[model samples]
Target: MDHDQINNQSRGAEGKDTKADGAAVAPQFSRDAVFPGEVVGEVTDLNRQDLEKQKAAQGSAHFHRLGWKRLTVVLIVEAIALGSLSLPAAFATLGMVPGVILCISLGLIAIYTSDVVGQVKLKFPHVSHYADAGQLMMGRFGYELVGAMFALQLTFLVSSHTLTGAIAFGNITNNGACSIVFAVVSAIILLILAIPPSFAEVAILGYIDFVSIILAIGITMIATGINKDSITTAPWSAWPQDGLTFAEAFIAITNIVFAYSFAICQFSFMDEMHTPSDYKKSIWALGLIEIFIYTLTGALIYAFVGQEVQSPALLSAGHTISKVAFGVGLPVIFISGSINTTVVGRYIHGRMYKDSIIRFINTKMGWITWLTLITVITVLAFIIAEAIPFFSELLSISSSLFISGFTFYFPAMMWFMLIREGSPFATHNLWKTALNGLCFVIGMIVLVCGTYASIVEIAHKFKTGAISSPFTCAALA
Candidate 1:
């Protein structure tokens, strides 16, 4: 005759499983007990309406399920398409051995940090995208900073790809028609790629990614084997390898860092993946492939063109083959790279404009502004590449700083934060901490040294009146 008796009576009255006769009817429970809201027995019966609402809610979450194969493919494509062309140019500038080593080292660091970030996102599935990660992990400032950085990276990526295409287009077709053909074709390619919202879809991006890698690797192999004579290097002893100060080494390494900095894309790709567990395995495969390709290409370039050669990748691949491949691959690569950049940038942008900014410029105007800015930068890159024969050097140096920070430093710092904030001991085991520490220390050293070397090189150039400014470049005195 207590609470249990009341519950039993109520169930019986509702036809569940108890007695309902008045002779022993347990005390009539208050209407409040029957239903928490209205007065008396006016409360309606619980029926199909409630069940339907629950089902609908559960159904909405189904879209987030991702498949493992799709994720692996996307990550691999990102790594290969971005890494292949970039490594050759970087190695050419930094010298073969140093260039290859720097890429492998930084790539490993970037991969580890990204894994940590992935784990954090998995822990909080509700806040799973890049913008959310930035805000949740680092706060408002972090969100804004990451967004701006991503936007700039996209601009650089598009510009670089466009220029490479333009150069090849010019070289392959007619001499005078370079700029027009380059700009038009590259822009068209970008527009085509822009049709896809997520750009992670396999049909369009996978084709471009696969074809470009094949052509690039095939051309490189053919050119190197066919023209082996061009690749003979001096003995290790008599090599012009004497008197390279620490500054020189640092500057060279910086160029390599920039070339390899495409690590930020790894996170976006990973997050998009259906199964997060495959992230590490996919990374290892891509890293190993990059290491092998870059190592072989660098060695060949060193042997053939040596230090005196500019743009070794282009030269090593020869005039006809390199020109044709770049002519096609350049536009495709640029467009594909831009998509990844935009995804990262837009993700960041959404996080930043949460308040008034969202109200002000969240329409077509914002999209147009971003596109226009990228177009202008593309033009500037064309002019600069035309004027400065050593323009790749400039790209390598500046990009090194960006790559070092985005790929190595930022990820490591976030890992540190996650560990401190009481992530499971298993996730942040001792070996991981040590590895993260090693990556951080090495990345810092590379960043500092790379900066110093770039400064010295610029100073030397200015003294000789080589490049007057961003707008002007003239012969040395």
Candidate 2:
């Protein structure tokens, strides 16, 4: 029988009010009836499409309408929120020369990982579904692990942002209001962000872009001029002491990469775009611009602020104006980005647990669960920040560990699986096996060394009186 005859018979099988027992029946017109060869054609087309999509998705390509200006704005927001805040620490760990080089190199890596490889994953429908990347790269177990990791990361990140928000609010008011204001304001922000509003509704995104850049640039100028004058009379030029080695420097660089690169989140966001193909070009452009910004900021901080300062001005004691900018700026980026990240994390987690006894874990529950988890995490962040002298250090170390596992380790393993499953056919680049393996190996080294360094520093601080909570802030002082 022809394809039309088969479809007509299938439609008639549902008892559509058609009077043809021998002849082909014209089924009642419904939305799905416009296409005649619906069932088999759909199944065949979907499978073929998915197969092609999987290949492209694994490449981490993406498509969209984001032009240079919009991309730059996004990078500026990210730079201020995540990169600029950590510039001082990077300089402290790597020194002026190595630190500048490391920042440039890692910034490039971050760009490639996020814009290039991550974009491929973002372009195709269903293929780029955050957890599906795990499945594609690994298998069922990989999917579960990615889901769990994402859930934890979101919980911790949201909490950290809330803490930052509370602290910023406290700075503005200066009445030690980080506690009450932190919880209430952060919860409200999360609620607003979690509703999945369009880019138009994300007014804070623009605020974040404007405020972060202004603050960073303003502080760089003031701090440079002031610190330069102070350091000029001192005559100590031999790379201010930090007591770090080559291996330590290498691990430091790795940690910086983990800090700057959020490719996993970038890949997952592909679903939000109307066109995924924009990824290949846009990501490269975004990465290049971000790298320049990050490199310049790091170099400026190192050259002006010197290694002796405890933290970045933004992190430490910014001028009243800069402080105000940072105080408000950090929270806007935090809540806005975290809400979207949480939504993705929850969706992945719900799917993983959907078939278990906890079958009620749908999208609605995902949001609720994510919100509750975020609230708890936020409280912990406040307590930790309040009590621990080295809380930022600990947070950075933990974040690195999280990225190492989720971004570096799991993806590497999955790519290996792809090789095993279909050799050259499954993954176009046979070299990925070697490249991914190297990343996994290097990641493991960073994980072990960085974690140990963090623990040791925490122990030292505890022996003294630097911090009250070891777990809350033990990375280093």
Highest TM-score against the true fold, candidate: 1
Per-residue lDDT of model 2, residues 1-477, tens digit only: 556865776575556444566554543443443244444333344444554455445322322333434444443443335345566556666766766676676666455345434433543356544566676666798677776666556555655565556555555655444355554565456555644322222334645555655565556546555656564333222353556765455445654565564555554444445555665565676566656666676666556655643343454334465455555465455644454444454465446554432222223454466556545544554455455556656765776676776546655664555323456334656665566666677568667777767676666667787664433321222
Q: How displaced is residue 158 in candidate 1, in Å?
A: 1.8
Error of 1 at 223 (Å): 1.6
TM-scores of the candidates in the order shown: 0.69, 0.68
Off by over 4 Å in 2: 1-83, 115-124, 175-187, 197-207, 231-242, 245-255, 315-322, 327-337, 344-394, 419-434, 469-477
Report the number of the highest-lDDT candidate.
Answer: 1
lDDT of each: 0.55, 0.53
In candidate 2 the C-alpha lDDT for residue 351 amounts to: 62
Q: What TM-score quantifies how close candidate 1 is to the native fold?
A: 0.69
Worst 10 residues of 2 by lDDT: 468-477
Clashes of 1: 3
